[model samples]
Target: MVGKKSGKALRDEGLERTDNNMDLSSWPQVQAINQKNYYTDYLKRDDQYLAFRLQNEEARTKMTKTAKDRDRALAMAKPEGAEGEAEADGDATMEDAEDTPIETAGSKVIVIHVGSQNLRIGLSSDALPKTVPMVIARKASKNESEDHPEPKPKRVKRDDGTAEEPENLFGEEWSSQFNRMSADLKVHMRQNKRRMLPNSKEMVVNFNRRTVPETISEHNDPMRVEWTELSKPPPEYIVGQPALRLPDSSNPRYKLYWPILNGCCNETDYKSKRELFLDISLILEDAIKTQLGLTSKKNWPQYSCVFVIPDLYEKSYVNQVLEMLMREFAFARVCFIQESLAATFGAGFTSACVVDIGAQKTSICCVEEGMCVENSRVNLKMGGRDVTETFIQMMLHDHFPYTDINLWRRYDFLLAEELKKNLCTMDEASVSPQVFDFHLRVAGQDTQKHTFKAFDEVHLAPMGFFEPTIFDNSDKLLGRRKLIERSVDIYDGQSNDPVSTAQSEILTALAPPLPKANGDSQPASSEVQATPARPQQPSALGRLQDQDQTPRSSVAGSPVPETNGTPQAGGANTPAAAPTTQPSHPAVESRDDILPVFPLDNAILTSIAHAARSDEKKMKDFIGGYYGRWRGHLDQWFLDERLRSLRPAFTKDIMIGVPPRDLDPQVVVWKGASIFGKLNATNDSWIGQLEYDRLGHRLMAYKCMWAY
Candidate 1:
């Protein structure tokens, strides 16, 4: 009874004894006891307990700091002077300075933008890319040398055998005819100007015209490099500007080759795929060595590459280029962005209908949210060069001052190109006949200054894009060769060995396979028949059709199944009893089709229609705005008509974005690629060296940001 009586008294007695002992104990013993208790508790607790304690400590610290801030703000009195405002701004700046810098994997990136006319290459840090003409000159073989011997400069002599007085390079009759034609054209243009509707007139204002001081335009004389001035002969292989500068006399010794043509690989020039790739490698190697100043291949491994490809690209072209970068050049990593997407990025637009009129091709694509709508891609086989050729043809017919204009000759080609750039104008106000001077400078010959008169020819040349029939007279169109689409490995169709049926079946599970030939089809085995069918998922098109109430078929002209059956009113012999047929919509011909190429306007409309089928938002974006990148003259009449036609399809007026005055349309794609190069890298989007090593060229399919 005495022992149990005092449970509360015993606790109270123990607490009093502990307090008395603590007051009497030494400090060292007290510290040792506390440390022992902490170690015992630490050993008993799990990681979860420790984590909870750490989180609680963090919360308490944050709350204390916040309270301190609040108290300081309440204690400080607001000041009314500029000094007080400066102090407030300084505090804001200090707070902003605490933010960490964003990390990017583009420090050592090498951005490459390859085009038919030029190859742009530079580091991601470069403000402007180093441009090189996409042309190479190699030593001619023995057969080529035999076939194209050097031609001695020929002088036209009169029948009397004495050298005739230098005739007007422009024949007298030809000059007279052109002079009259120019006058007539001027009259017609004036009449057309008068007929233009007042409401349709474009109002242009030059607010800075008076403020802008007139500066004297300086003309630099072309550098005279005589053959005798050269201490050594040209190198065995010449690339870029050097190749373009080679005198016509050197044509026999060197065979000029363009690695790309009409926005694709120039496969027709080379006898084999290996040779084509070799030439491409050589050109790229030269650019990296000379322009980048990375003379040794050893440094290439340290850099990553952002290759800008065409919007309507060939899979083989992408694969080969990737392989060349990762395997041939040993790049650290590789990524690909379509030209349209890169153009949008460079131009800083979230959505646009990119109309890129390049040197040899005009590509159209609708880009949305950094992704290109594949169905909207259209590549025309004509561009700036076509305009140049057409311009030259017009000049020739109009008694051009330079009658010896042969595009095959380097000097003549350069002179014609220069003339085109200087004279061509899209503005109607600038189309009056004007006298322009050009200095014809050919290597190993004296520079000759010639004055020429240009009228409608300047504007008419660029009109070839709208009225393509004008290009029919040019040799480029007549002599154009059809190039076979190149493929690799399994796609090449050269393999004699049969493809594995098991692999085909696996692919079929993912997507419907192409119909097999009657001879290729094999009987299924009992084991194959016994296997259970995998659940089939609806395809994108199928799902879209499902959402739509209208009966539809995947292929045009294919019969649609009748969901609601009704007995025919007519007998079996009647026409109504026969199966009803849906009229087939005319298919848009492919690039390889023998039919005429689709017109630009129709192509754009078709692209928009395809976009509508897949996504309504994307269709709106496609019709929203146009970003034109044309170096040559743009046909305003055609463009305006296209816009007018599209107005009914959209509620809002379509916009055509005008590029900044300082931006060069020719290099916009390259600039976009540079922008992409600076973006933060993602493992799934970029193909690093390790991934390339494991997957080879196939890495593009898995790692490419867009659908491969």
Candidate 2:
């Protein structure tokens, strides 16, 4: 407001003046001036502000220069050796990077492997996951507490001293007698007619001989356990190991349930989808709280999770699980990996035919590199539990010592499972009848020793996989349960057209009349002719009208009039109407449409054939080995024999490689999940809460690593 001063006068007074009055909020020079004034004032009045400003200045001076700055310095004739020394320092830093702990999200990562029988959970840094039986025992209501009367125990058969002892068939004397009998039988068969011409070329078979130990160790008895009856009242809920150990006597107080069955959600067992989801949530929450020591909900936001899903998975199942982890558990972020891919990672194989036989389901898929081959996935709705039930049936038929055995009971179920593991063998050496003794220990009862002999029962029990018909004879529903149907992806929209019902009905009713078969054509009615004709174009329903066809009336919901085979007065220029038909849509094939069960050998061959259709190299690589969670009774040779017997032509060039004996197949999937969890690139693939909130299910299409 004062009188304007000259430039030299303003310089002398250290003051500046301007005539322009427009807003300078966006002006860089004005901003610099204001910032400098604020900084100076704060430096004088605030000690913290002064210290912060000094620290920022020091950091700015030490920061590395940009390319432009380096080029300018070189133009000024600075030393060239400085750039080389800087690069040398960077190289040295990279070389020593191994000693530095990788700064990654893995430290806060929790890997969860949810299986039908067990739930494996642990941090990414853990050497092994904490395994818990995927079972829950809910407290029963008063109405559910009615108990059934227990059956009386069967009387044990006494070994009478009057019977004569049979000759030992496994001793040396019996072997000599068998050889003599075989020689006489061979002579009689030599005179039989030749079935076919002999091969022109001699076929040679190579066998890898394994040395047997000179001193065999005694088989340890697995039947020494004593089952103690629970005397206390059941809690609100039981999970994991304790749930499995609940005695049969306490069955009236609790109801046992397995939330997952046959590699899919056990929705059929629950009242609604909500209840099934609730149980699954409770199981995971309990496992995380007790096993991972994460008791506080507030701390959950600090951790991320990686869920392992099936190779042939349902989109809805995966979506529901992700929602549960994110919205219910409040995890920071979540990611998913396929089981077959994870198995390949854990086994350190670039490509392999993964035959993952779990407690309730067996999944076959060929994984190359890190991706699973499409169409090669086959999920069989049968596994170890089927074998267990089959074994129990076989034993019962042979008058098993425990005649009152009920597999539904906890004790008897455990007993049968243990007996199958102990007595079953695929080796030809143990094909003869063998005597096995098991000590039956019931809660609140005396221990009793029971002796039984098994001949082909042990062998036939495990053969249920190859001969699935044996499972049909048992009470268990084999391959009856269907997988959850996959929901339509949000990105694909709906399968049906978006036309309104009323609009479609009106359009159908107003459809033009069909013309006669002769060359002559009838003219349209006066009402149709009176309406203003618009340019012909495709309708909203995506149907196109031909120019030669009769023009349709624009009036909505109009009814067709009776022509009585008479032509209109002004008729001759109209063209004949073409025949119109409804568009046909192809039926969409779902998971339920496919067969749910495949024999062991057939599944392998089908999987290889599927791979061969895509890439022959992948098929050859997959046929090289069969990697899976095999039991002690089912060896590689057994699978090989089944393949040869089922399809001799297919097995002609196939050689199945055996995995290392010491490699535990049980934890292979879990280990692979852990490996995926530790990957630095996983950070970018995780779906965070903010992203999910904005996109919802649509986020899966963009963020999911696999084919969503």
Candidate 3:
């Protein structure tokens, strides 16, 4: 970072700090990503293997098991505390006090933990576990909505009953509800309006980026027609005022654009852990209506389920992805497991840790004796995508030295998934383990030498909450300086601007003084300045003389060929620029003088205005940590309390599965999510609106680790 400009310096001319997110098309497609061949290509060939969602057959059986066990446990449990303790003191028969249930509802049960990826259903009778993916068809829309846009007529019971809705008949699966909703009084939120207010700050935060930007205008071309002059208005309105031209402004489907879970229209606007939960649940409930008819409240099914996800687990994508899932199951409930203790009971892993590796980030947490530890948790920016990007860069540098988008196209998402399932782990044995080689070719020509097997198992990969670094056998292993320097020399625009020149200097300037492979102490850099045309090149070379071992790789490549196809670098005859290599990634740092980013809900209106005027770098700085931390904190809190009460009931270890609608309430379920925006654990989670045994027990858990 020596010669590299800090984010502030990069803010003016539009160079992003981190190039994580470049161009992601949001244009509505004829098909959803789920319906596309691209996404399905990665699914393992064992597609026949069952996905363990709450509705799976095995999950139904668990509900029966849990109900039985709960009946037994309560029967065997001691009665009132002191009195029973005293009675058991002498008469051994006192142990038979039997903490029996107040009455017998005679109902079986199951706990459904709705996860972003999978839905788990637990049976109480046997505590058998079954899970099915939360996945439904993205293309499976309301096949009947348009034809029948009305809520199914409600049924009334005459058995001395008050008017009631489907709440009494809640056990309906999501698929069947969609059809029913279409046939009934249909509900839709498409009529609402949303707009982000403006600000005078003249800077904006870009929400769609994966990494913090070095400059605000890096990716976005904000339409800004600064008023240079004003023209008089027509006749009556022309009273001494001048007419001004403004860029067209509109916010269509703004509600659809904000985060599905956290984006509230107002402070008290449908926000609460419950509302978020209800959103997915309601969507799912509607999905089920589409496939089945409804009955009177008294004749309704017995359970409800909603998808739960840790806020930061899938990076900040949890909400966006959940929305996509909701597109599949309308009544789906996407809950942040870390924000609700009930979620921990849903994921199923108690007395252990859950570590989730998602697309853009990683998160970990622990549950002890079925209770999650609120204070202990970990979240990192590096996730499967980050790792894959590193791989892609490696392939570009070592394998394909060309710049053809097609060669490396159509795989950003697929490759990221591969990293999640195929890479990442802890291996303490071999000298180098997690690293492996990759092949990359844009147009043609060797770009870089691939090296890396897994995350950090080979060469040390960066690891930290914010900052990270790795080893480099090549020159200057800090920023992507060397490669950037080469790019400057090769490009036609040359090194005119401050950024290009500054980058070149950052790369070649700090030449670590060291002997060549032959071990010869190099000459002084001041004496190395040789070219007048590339004025600063030789002077920058002086910095390399001090390194123990200077690097060799440049930023992702050596120039390829001319349009006519010819090699662009050092040949057998030409002794060119000294081989300069550097670290694979650009060094990202947090600075004290850094621009401030406010809490999202605190100043929404002003932030929106600033975002419109400012560039991408400033925008990311404003939103980066705030959005990430909000979700992280939420996941932590939700899990802690949910697991507290489930501890005693986990008397015996067992794998729980899904149960039927009539039997779902008798079992426990677990859900996992990230720790941001998470509330602290508490003891009042026994009354969760989840399916539980007659004993009134509901268990929850999240995906994470204790790091022990």
- The numbered model that scores best in lDDT is 2
lDDT of 2 by residue, 1-708 (tens): 899788999878888566688765775653345654454453364334423344345447656456568787557552567878767866876789867888554669999999888899999888789999898877764211123233211112325623121122122332233334324323432443312212201110000011111321223334444433444563677787777776656645666678887888885455677877788888999999999999998999999998999987777788899999999999988988889888888888888888888888888887876788765676767788778876765555445555566666666767777898888776544544456667655555555666666655676677667545345322222222343444653577542211222122222222333345885444666654332222111131112112213343211111122234323212123322222233111121131222244356655655665555535455556776657665564767778766555334346545654444455778878888888888854334577777677667666665556667
Which pairs in model 1 have colliding backbones? none
TM-score of each predicted structure versus truth? 0.61, 0.61, 0.27
Q: Best by TM-score, which number?
A: 1
lDDT of 1 at 325: 90
- State the lDDT of candidate 1 residue by residue for 218-270, as single tens digits: 23444543331222564667788887776656534666788887787786566
TM-score of 3: 0.27
Candidate 1 has an lDDT of 0.58
State in Å the error of residue 378, model 2. Answer: 0.4
Candidate 2: TM-score?
0.61
The C-alpha local distance difference test score for the whole of candidate 3 amounts to 0.28
By summed lDDT, the worst window of 10 consecutive residues in model 2 runs over 200-209
Which regions of candidate 3 are displaced past 4 Å?
Answer: 1-301, 306-356, 366-370, 377-382, 400-412, 423-708
Backbone clash total for model 1 is 0
